[model samples]
Target chain A: DAGITQSPRHKVTETGTPVTLRCHQTENHRYMYWYRQDPGHGLRLIHYSYGVKDTDKGEVSDGYSVSRSKTEDFLLTLESATSSQTSVYFCAIRPQVYSGNTIYFGEGSWLTVV
Target chain B: DQQVKQNSPSLSVQEGRISILNCDYTNSMFDYFLWYKKYPAEGPTFLISISSIKDKNEDGRFTVFLNKSAKHLSLHIVPSQPGDSAVYFCAASSPGAGSYQLTFGKGTKLSVIP
Candidate 1:
């Protein structure tokens, strides 16, 4: 298994509140990604980082932000929580080596907005 | 519109039987395909992958077949076990598309009955 850890495995927040999910990896991977999984939607990328301080938005970047100051840490923040944002968020890392472009994922963070 | 589609929402198979999950993509630029397995309340794990240059790739009990001409891919699990019951997602990407992003399908739930 990849040495990826997501903080606050589960959380419940009220609407309009701020929420931040942290992803820490010990593998020293060059690329990191944040994705959300929902019923009927599967996993949608929110943001990803290619290197330290280099990040880009993904398909579902609305209302969410990400920052990566170090190679081992990637953070995803929900500026204002919404009911629609409730889903399981997963952090993934891709090794620099060619492993058929495979990305390993963390356990997951469950978030709920009421 | 969804670029990657898994038309079947769910499938069931008896233990020790073969389980097949299908996926299709509309984008012609996609050259890399992958399959992931996920259980309830957990992150998705990479299962298998196949490059466009190859038509098939296998690992142990899992085999991935890609048909570039049809823009379709399928995952086959031989002698499926109850523990193999989970949601399977198919993803595709184009290395030349700029970012290291993968478009995923809605996923198919596989139920392996005893």
Candidate 2:
């Protein structure tokens, strides 16, 4: 286990509401990522952090934002949730020790926007 | 445009048979490939990975084959068991800064039928 934990495993909210998902890791990895999984689109990167307070946009990052204030916590926020933004969000971490480009994922957060 | 593609949405294999999941990529810069297995309501777990320099990597009953020339990869599961049923995702990444971010293909759902 990578010791990754994601909060708000399931949620339903009205459109235009704000939602924040939290990902906490026990292993102090330097890299953390947020991704959304949709039926036909698979998993798309939303944002990633290489270190505390350092972040960058991924392939699909228009409506989402992320923050990594500490080594173990990464937060993803939907400024204004929309129906199209409904998806299963996943948090992943890459261990610095491993030479291979493999990242471990946490249990996903399921969000439904109506 | 999708950088990676998994054309097959679903596949079924009899128990003890071999299950092959194929993936193709459009980006030649992707040098590292990975496969992830995800069960319903859970996060995707890392399965196996291969570097661009190698054509194949194996772990027990699971093997991943890469064809750099064709920009394709396949995951082979030998003696498939019912427990192997899950969504398999193919992901790739290039080398350099931000290389930890992976581009994923739409997943292929695998069902190992008894």
Candidate 1 chain A — worst ten consecutive residues by lDDT sum? A94-103
Of candidate 1 chain B, the 10-residue stretch with the lowest lDDT total is B94-103
Candidate-wise lDDT, in order: 0.93, 0.93
* lDDT of prediction 2: 0.93
TM per candidate, chain B? 0.97, 0.98
Q: Name model 2 segments beyond 4 Å from true.
A: B97-99
What value does the lDDT take at residue B9 in candidate 2? 100
TM-score of 1: 0.97
True contacts kept of each: 0.62, 0.84
Report the C-alpha lDDT of model 1 over B1-114, residue by residue, as the tens digit.
899999999999999999999999999999999999999888899999999999999999999999988999999999899999999999998977545688899999999999
Q: What would the per-residue lDDT of candidate 1 be over residues A1-114, giving only the tens digit for each residue? A: 878999999999999999999999987899899999988898999999989999998989999999998888999999999999999999998877778678889999999999
Interface RMSD of 2: 0.9
